[model samples]
Target: MNEGKLPEWLHCNKCNAFINSLSNDSRLYILECTHIVCKKCAFARQRQSGNVLCPVCGTTCAAKCIGGDELPHDVQLFMDQSMVLSELDRLRYCVQVTLLAQLR
Candidate 1:
């Protein structure tokens, strides 16, 4: 599908936020009727309604998450921080073990 520039007012119907078509960090799910929605909003709607339906067109469409590699910047940053904390915990454990051995 052609990734054309989304109109300025083309916001997610659920969240009412701009779809951020300019950023690779924002994921969007396009409905069969050409309506676009953000990933989070789409998932929430699917959970609430038990089916994915286009809010604008009232058409049932498959809600597939797009932009897997383009997750929101804040989310990506949080994942990075979590990984760093996990590594630090592992290193601290190793250091404690070494110090205990020396004391013994």
Candidate 2:
């Protein structure tokens, strides 16, 4: 999603970067804690905490919430890049095999 398209006020709780929801329904939520973090950040945070604190309010909240999911941009980008790299590797491997067969 385009960071420019996001509203001025909306930002990721951790990095303060633009929080772009994959879908229109996504939103930042405090997991019963005081902190209010974007879903993406919260997921990452959850991994560390047995129960993560709400970035907004610091209240301890369960892993599950209404939406209860983070859509971190970095994670998405990394996953995308991973797919691209994997495809490139596959293509290169195929080319290498073809070349070896032709030489034989």
* Number of clashes recorded per candidate: 0, 16
Candidates in order: C-alpha RMSD to true structure: 12.0, 11.1
How many Å off is the CA of 46 in candidate 1?
A: 2.2
lDDT of 1 at 75: 29
C-alpha lDDT of candidate 1 relative to the true structure:
0.58
Can you give the lDDT of residue 63 in candidate 2? 44
Over 1-104, each residue of candidate 1 has an lDDT whose tens digit, in order, gives 12333444456766687764545456666665666678666655463555676766677777643334443332222233556688789999999999999999
Best by lDDT: 1
lDDT of 2 by residue, 1-104 (tens): 23323343556566575644545445554445434566666666563447775554555676442222353443323234556688789999999999999999
lDDT minimum window of 10 residues, candidate 1: 71-80
